[model samples]
Target: MLTTRPERWDRVVDAIIVGSGGAALTAATMAHDGGAEVLVLEKASLIGGTTAVSGGVVWLPGNHHMAEVGISDSREDALAYLRRLTCGHEHDPAVLETFVDTAPEVLSYLEANTPLRMQPVANFPDYFFAYDVPGKKSGGRSCEPLPYAVGDEIPEWRDRLVTRGTLMSLGSNTMLAEDFAEPTEELKAELARREAQDIRTKGAALIAMLFKGLLERGVELLLETPVRELIVVDGSVIGVRAEANGQSIFVAARKGVVLACGGYEWNKEMVRAFIGYEVQPLSPPNNVGDGLVMAMEAGAQLANMTSYFGQPAMFDPEISRDGELVPQFEWGRGAPGSLIVNRTGARFANEAMPYNDFPKAFGAYDATQNEFPNEGPGWMIFDQGVRDSTRILSMIPGRPTPDWVPVANSIRDLAALIGLDADTLEATVATFDENASQGRDPLFHRTELGLMAPGAVRPLNQGPFYAVVIWPGALGTNGGPRLDTNGQVRGYRTPVIDGLYAAGNTAASAYAWAYPGGGATIANGMVFGFRAGRHLAAQPARDI
Candidate 1:
């Protein structure tokens, strides 16, 4: 794990991959196995990017393992489901078909060739699984990597991992796809007993195995190497210019270059321009959209530029962890005995909707005869009943309350503190309670979403309430360079750019509008990344 960037430059490799996340590493391993020399460049100091901090679930419909578990899925069904989910968005049909057909193939390849093995999550249901669509499914598409056993004798790799810290200390990844989080008393005791053993779960285990596979395939990885721009020879991308160890280095690509350097959530300008709202990113700061910018400069067309993969988040202005203020995701939205409302103190979308669809409710537009206000934040209000039954974020069950959470004995006081209409808040709570008693939502229908538990429908009429300000937050942007089915980066209104490719967050996502399930991004990232690697290896070597 103690690796350094090479001081040499002007060298050529069969394929140059600009990233070191799951996508980039998958590409590198496949390229090397295809009998081509592969080099991977990561802008961050460490190899694993944001993918390491994610929930580590991969959504692969009709994957080989599902049938073994008695769950049925097919390639045709997956395509139909994707088509229904995407609606009327302009996208390459060939690319969509390739994603569906090759999703399981890539999984099989990784399991057989690499150190990675995934098991289907039986309890995790789809966001739209309740519907009667032709290709609809109930569960088993989501697969999670098994935790890495401790005492493997890799201390250096263990030291390099970055934890999500307070944000995920108690988060629930999934029942079957669960990571090492939300430790109960018994689990805490077990973790303490195994503290020195260095058991890694979730993203840490995923990247470790991928890196091991890459090393076995003889792929060269260079960390702290930020690609500046693509090197074009007569309108065809042939290589990349990057910064390595404080020096400009030009590396030629004899076959192609794959851009998988994540997305632009940390780039304030890009976030402001596309989302039209202030956001606190859930991803690391290194995801500054360098690949996205470079692709645009290379005349690549952008898709889904106005949309992003985001959820609701907020900050505790007074609470700092590790001497810095900790911004927490508003998981309280789905907690029982709670409700979210706008400044007017009226409920908008279903509070229990899928996390990916929650933020979109704030920005929905009607264009026939435009009727909407600007996108804005909301107030998450809850009662002490919730504080008793569930953990409201960092709040301890019986500990003394902190000043960061605005509290009041009455709903009026809580509304006033959060700058909401007290009367409207009272009315909203009263009506919601009446509907909850009967298990009916004439409005948003929280029970129908399938993402929320019945606990989310508990009444909210108890005294002593709490509230917090929450805003739309993105984990990463899904827009970037367009690509064909074969993973070649596409130019605007023209043919594919020679020797240039994109995958992961740097490529415009196929399902631009909807999130298929838990591991939509990673599954697509790996599938297309492997495609880019094999495609680049098959091409004739450049004469540069």
Candidate 2:
């Protein structure tokens, strides 16, 4: 077992936070406000993990902003929607209730305590719709943080943040939370202007705000310092052991430790063991289950190991720039002349479904054919016009099709290129085009959703069709050490491990199947991180 010499502690604080993203930074800020001296440690040299490279939207149903923004959503309505979403998982009712009740508190707290400011995404829809209730189809509850100018904020830490991992931060382009309401030519011009301006939006802005808050709170943060093991004494977690500059250092925590050190996406062994498949990872490479392993060695109970957030992405060997495999999230699947078909050349899913829910369609099993994955490698079929209109991942839109991307002269040729029956492909396109011409998808009813844009429902009748093999690209693993509402990590059999807490992807997700809306993942982390920090700060100081 790994041990720590508390008497030789290098640094001691009331709270020690693991990771340096939204969750850790928020926890540090709150813990400091709660009168706890804090130290944040990040394994990576960069401060933001995937959170710094993502859309920094927070999905909080029934938040106060909903009412203020003219959204008529209630707590009961949010609960009912959640129950509908996770009803099959047999999840603890209290967790959902706590999230629903405390989400507003998390948002209000950030608004009051930090530089983070958010506005409601009045038009954003839940990844899944309200099947049984009215006004639940499209979510009016989602909100995104306002963008921050890099020159205006932390000019020194500019390069230390993770910006290349997300579409919003790609190149010099950045998008505002409110700009998503409508796509106009004027909007394009504005977007171009912002892209040239070096503005930080979405996830970057969130981390910047949180980082600024932490710095202001006097929290000491160490980059490239990984927690190697837990320091346990008499079955109690007293501190964590880490290595920096080839020296073993133990940081003592007087009150508690909040583990927000991300998830196990980069760990292939854990991926196969938990998610039942080997998926191309899209999260930061350092997310290799380090936190989960350390917690388990300390007797923490891990649960919901099978849940993950993923989407279909083509990992083209030639066009894989910066390991950009998944174009589904960036270009999105719903171009006017595109359709995703199974091995049988039949349209199996609503092409307009959000990427998170779209992955579930690939889970179809063909028992009669003995195919374990009936929809394996759903070929995304598009026409030259579609490719010409918009960018598909690393490949620029309106540009000639590259040799790396599979293409053909017609639907039959595309089917043959992708190993599908020509007749079936032709028929599927004929039926789909007929429906799309009328803005109707009678086969799957994709565009019927209130959340899906009408532009996504256009016809695919143009010539010179193209196809590409795509598989589910995992964003990250969601399962990890179990925690109570207070974010206190629980032991295998014990109710709670006293000085232990977890938040973000380091812990099992409360809702796992389908994404609630945009920024749901970050919002979950923020809410839980808020709880963990408050709970830890409320505790009396303990002697190291």
Candidate 3:
């Protein structure tokens, strides 16, 4: 934190927003609408953060759009569901209440202010829908931005998004939560039309719509400008010292600086220090906890430091970003003919569990053995039947196994190739096959056979088996500076940091370890961001 205020500021704005994801942009829009002069600074040359590459679904519990999909949600139901999910977890129940109360309103505001049109993801179930959980909707609580003809509105921003392609295995052709079933001729033609028009769907559409709103409001968004530190005056954050063109630029915030600079998943030091485990991040390389560091320097209290949105990630040599191999997030471990086994060739989890919940099994400790028995280097073992019917990483059905994936004609040979105990592996596969043939998973009691589609329980007896190493990965880290209901950053010594605020992955997640639905991350970040922006806009201008 910068203690001394600069005599002159390079630029002045009522609110200086850091990061350019859903959270940051939402705050910017809200602040701008609330009569504050907002300036958004992005560290990456691109505009969107992980939000751009995500599924772009927004979890709105009592959203108006739910009715369109024949789903009903009440505030009480929403609260009950969240409360049950977050029970015994390190989270603020009040924050969850606040989010439940504020989210629908924020969604309404966003729809009114931005060019975003939302629709329920068709038949998309909440992560815990199958569980006996109250307030869990089988579908419709999570909605996504409709396809937007972005090129028609902002042609200049067409090529500037971080990645038009999503982190999801379902390629760019599919919209939010749309399945990977073979497309009909009409659907293919529609997709072709969208491609020709440079129309974006899902996360891309969400960001483009928000960006369009910012552009319309004349909000000054500077790309490649990273805020280095906060300029504190009398224990309150008043401005920021940012870097641009290899020079330090001091920018004054009359109201406050909102840190929405995403999570620390990419920061190896911070990840090792805080998360205390290996986390393969699915987000952009720029999300290195800049806001968290600044908040820590400002004496901000941290919360939920060890929690993250976890997923089972598979390393695919063909996929990379920023010259680094980007692991493909795999949520289909429970697909028929597939199972993940530890180094001992033992299956350890109900592989059909939610992606966020699945990695918890990876960290399961064997107290007797005094080690993490399930902590990977685990292998996702599958058969040619799966390869011929389902998609795994870049491997499409009917396509030859990618050389990167280890394959063998027998389960014992596959185990040998992947350094697993051949006898144990063969026995595990045999038992699984027998149980699967009986249409039962007595050991794990897995009810769901697939993630996106309903899969039949099939025996993995086909030859040419394949294996890929599975590791703990994440969409992003969801822990950092704690924020109050108003989205004001809480200080260690003070009740609140008067002017400093945080939202998104930069702030501790309100949901804690409970990931309610598909777009919980974006939804949680956006709600607080809206709150922060509204609160920041209402603040009186401070003196330099």
Q: lDDT for each of the candidates?
A: 0.76, 0.76, 0.86
TM-score computed on alpha carbons, candidate 1: 0.91
lDDT tens digits, residues 1-544, model 1?
Answer: 0012234447788889998887888888777888789989988877678777776778888888887778898888888888887885736778888888889888899999988877876567666675445686667788877655424734565656543223444332222333334657866565554444655556656777788788777777888889888887677777888888898888888888999999898888998897666666777778898888888877898888877777677776665668876556775676768888876788888887767777877776648648433256788888887777655556767877767888999888888888878899889988888887787667777766645232247677787998877777776788888889887889974688888888888888878756778788888788889899888888999876
Model 3 worst lDDT run, 10 consecutive residues: 447-456
Q: What 10-residue stretch in candidate 2 is worst by lDDT?
A: 168-177
Q: Pick the candidate with the highest TM-score.
A: 3
Steric clash pairs (candidate 1) = none
Per-residue lDDT tens digits for candidate 2, residues 1-544, read: 3555556888888898999877788788888999999999998988888788777778888777877666677788777777776754724567767888888888888888788888876667665662343336365578877766665577788778755345521433445444444667776777666556556777777887888888777788999898888887777778988889878898888898898998897888988788766566677678898889878887898877877776556655553456654333435477768888887888887777667766667766767877744356778888877878777765677565677777778888878777899999899999998888887888877766423343256667677777767676666677888888898898986788878899888888777554667777887788889989999999999978
Considering every candidate listed, which one attains the maximal lDDT?
3
Provide the TM-score for each candidate, comma-separated. Answer: 0.91, 0.89, 0.96
| Candidate 1: worst-modelled 10 consecutive residues by lDDT | 171-180
What are the runs in model 1 whose C-alpha is more than 4 Å off?
Answer: 1-9, 149-153, 163-194, 318-326, 365-374, 452-456
TM-score winner, 2 or 3: 3
Runs in model 3 with CA error above 4 Å?
177-182, 321-323, 448-456
The sequence of per-residue lDDT tens digits that candidate 3 reaches over residues 284-375 is 78889899999999999999998888888887789777787877787457778898898799999878877887776777778898987886
